[model samples]
Target: MGNVLGLESFYRRQLRQLLGIRHPRRISNAALYKRCNARPLRYRITKARWVLFGQVPRGSDRNPAFMQMARYFDSSTEGGW
Candidate 1:
């Protein structure tokens, strides 16, 4: 959770800097995202995670690494990453 918040904070700061937005000017995150035509960092991260996970199932069953991933996925508890 701390890492997620840190990444989001860094992302917002970089975007604000890129657009020359400074302390004096107040901007909502939604507005900032609209201006940049970008999604939130969390959404992007979630999408990337799903994409990677999707690839795991497509991997060859004969590969030891893929088999390990399969076992991990099957054994992992709910609410895990």
Candidate 2:
């Protein structure tokens, strides 16, 4: 979940910074749904993350829940990022 959010944020920020957009781009609900239905795993996990967590909370860089999520996904471990 955390990784998905991070991936989305990274892509969003890159698009905004590179394109000089003042606001985030609008997501196409229909297209997004179709993509998910067509390829659950191959499709972007960020959208799924958004559906599940609807804008994840922010605070410390080392939030415990974030760490635990990473660990569960095998992306990171106790030593932390």
Top TM-score hit: 1
Of candidate 2, the 10-residue stretch with the lowest lDDT total is 33-42
- Per-residue C-alpha lDDT of model 2 across residues 1-81, encoded as one tens digit per residue: 666567656655554455454555554434443544533332556567675553334544387766556566674356544
lDDT of model 1, residue 14: 94
lDDT of 1 by residue, 7-43 (tens): 9888988999999999999899899889999877788
Per-candidate TM vs. native? 0.73, 0.28
Best candidate, lDDT: 1
lDDT for model 2 comes to 0.52
Candidate 1, residue 42: Cα displacement in angstroms equals: 0.9
Q: Identify the runs in model 1 with alpha carbons over 4 angstroms from their true place.
A: 62-65, 72-81
Q: Which residue pairs show backbone clashes in model 1?
A: none
